[model samples]
Target: MPPPPARVPDLTALSLLVAIARTGNVGTAAHEVGLSVQAATARLRTVEQQVGAPVVERERRGRRAGRLTSRGVLLVEWAGPVLDAAADLDAVVAALRPARPGEQPIVLAAGPTAAEGLLPAWLVELRDGPGGQIVLLDTDDPAAAVRAGDATLGIVETVEPLEGLHATTVDTDTLVLVVAPDHPWAGGSGVDAAELVATPLVTRRPGAGTRASVEAALTAAAPDVRAPAPLREVAADTAVRAAVRAGEGPAVLPRRAVTGDLAAGNLAEVPVHGADLGREFRAVWKEGSSPQGTARDLLRIATGGRIR
Candidate 1:
């Protein structure tokens, strides 16, 4: 006997569900899906009923636990081929339609740290290569840009495992515990992970990948060491460094960001015992899509062809 076909979720609903899986917040996912939060909530409820599952979850160890159900994940997987086909169809229709007289340049989306610390230098070298232009779009969610066809290439810093796309590891960084030179921990050889988490270190906001990594490690190594919040939650890397330097508290940040300060005797590093919160810089593009011309050139330059 032939098996029953999988349920066909509404196209718009399925797309919204995928956005929820990507962003992990109904309101933010709603923004990405182009609906108001109220509308998104109602829509999600309808979809949940249609699919017979609860996809978005709740807090886990003081983190946003919103994630996809197995069925919701399946919907994301099923929606991918459809979205790709739609993109292809759009390309064909665009080809048949009258020319718009202006072409959309290739777009690049980069996380804040990578954009500030690394990408600019690499882009400077490209000035000698091509007359072709690339536009920069703002977002921390580089993988989302690739998924939504907003960018031909994207660079993201994330603690979450990379999935559901074609991506490459272009660079790596280690998170170090940085403190003001005069601080008590400065002379210490190392601080245990358990002790560090209990200290309310200066940190990025909850959703930032680096902070997420730190929380995950703390929850695993010593769940009892959890703090009510960060020592301080600042938006910018500069602000985080400034807060740490002001002797407010110690911080865990990428070594690249504070290596100069450490060298200048402004800050000191205390080893983090039992945890190495390493991070990767990824260049991502949509799965099953190929880059041509300048996009290909940029990928070669960015990754040296060693993409993961």
Candidate 2:
């Protein structure tokens, strides 16, 4: 009597069906739906069995067409109205949980040097501002993260133009020679190009931004000097720092990465003639993704009035 307890089809299978209809191929649709082609085909068959009707017509290995039977079509059409109602409900719930008066939840993706150390002070100031909530994700692939909408903002070392992201120069930072306090060079505040070349160095992995910038400067300064034999190669700035701290060997690091150590006398910045190796930091975001409210305010605070 109670309205036949309502017929319910598996949403996952239904979603896959919808994707298949739009993409016109099982393999392509499977990829969109995050399933393998064989799996999608099996799931489609199961849905058809549940409804007692075919929902798709297969052409080639991947090519498919929505072949909803009369009953299946009726069900598919009915899904539209049901989904619209669900969407409206979702909107209502989201609106009910509206952002606190001025607080914005912002995510920033950046290189380890800035994300782990440099940005904390600025972030604290922003947090004291009107509702500035921030999360930082440190990674070397900031460009990819920015393009994927994984973060509202990204700080990176290079100036390469990201295709769909807007980039603005933030500041220029230099690579400083760093060595453990016990190292022989520790007595000196710096080293010359010849000293750098002759030293057995602990360096970053090949493609790192710091490494690239240092290499370019090195080539310009002494094209004839052979590349230093690396004592060790590490992937992250933190790893490189730990290696240096272990007295591995002399290493090159960004000023931001070694600033505290330099200040504490744990490590000294080596002076090198014409070795003012530098790179531009950039703030990047999706081209049309405008920051609003708290995010906009936080961006301003983080940039420290230098968003030009």
Candidate 3:
């Protein structure tokens, strides 16, 4: 293959050529791309020089506007995909750019528990410090959001390892089995893992980090017993809390989520014997791409000034 062209018309010049082809008016095309007619004329001349061809035929005295030469028409057609690809690249870069420090509107994705319980405080701390606007996405699958470039950073509570992402433990939380005040387990000795695994419990819907962590803990504690399905699967932590408060069933949830209720005597925490329900609150980003700028500042706040 021959070497690439050492010089080519830039995107703006190529866009002008395409616009001229569509509008069939040099001045209108120039205006569309934010250029004065005279400056556009000069740019067209430069493009022609770079391409070694005349790309436009100037408007004659009687004609209303100028039109592209045959070569110009071909150049516009060739630049179509190039311009499209450049636009696509620009969008991707914009999506990723917010992760860089100082980018506005830092996009953050967080699991339901963190969004409801933790992020408010962290955001308040961020506002008090190196502050910037933040777009908070409350999601069940925060890792997916970060991986897809929809979020600059993600906070998740999970026991499962995240693949292809850089994760740092920002905090630790425990999943506790909680029941309404009147439930049998509320007053009795804590239930064992086998019994806990056998009971149907209200829970967050599948794919939620809390639900996954609870399931993993149960399965680990009772390898031979398949954990029963949820009594009711709700979309949000608040819904799950409501369901449990209404005496729907027991739910294993992040302690932080039910702390207020527990304190208010609306919910009772039940111990799960021989089961480890601890999980880490982690901040995750795309592997090889650490958080920067406002995102870094926010992460620092989340981790209490420790970023690792």
Highest-lDDT candidate: 3
lDDT of each residue in 64-169, candidate 3, tens digit only: 2468888888899999999987764553334333444654687888876676667766765676578666777767889999999998999877657899899988
Model 2 Cα lDDT, one tens digit per residue, 173-246: 87888888898877765667766776667877775667777777777777778875789988777787778887
lDDT of model 1 at residue 187?
84
lDDT of the candidates, in the order given: 0.73, 0.70, 0.82
What lDDT score goes with residue 179 in model 3? Answer: 95
- TM-scores of the candidates are 0.62, 0.54, 0.62
User: Which residue window of length 10 is worst by lDDT in model 2?
Assistant: 89-98
> Candidate 2 overall Cα lDDT vs. reference?
0.70
- Model 1 spans > 4 angstroms off: 1-103, 159-161, 305-308
* Model 1 lDDT at residue 74: 78
| Global Cα RMSD, each model | 20.2, 18.6, 17.8
Off by over 4 Å in 3: 1-104, 160-163
Model 1: how large is the Cα RMSD against the reference? 20.2
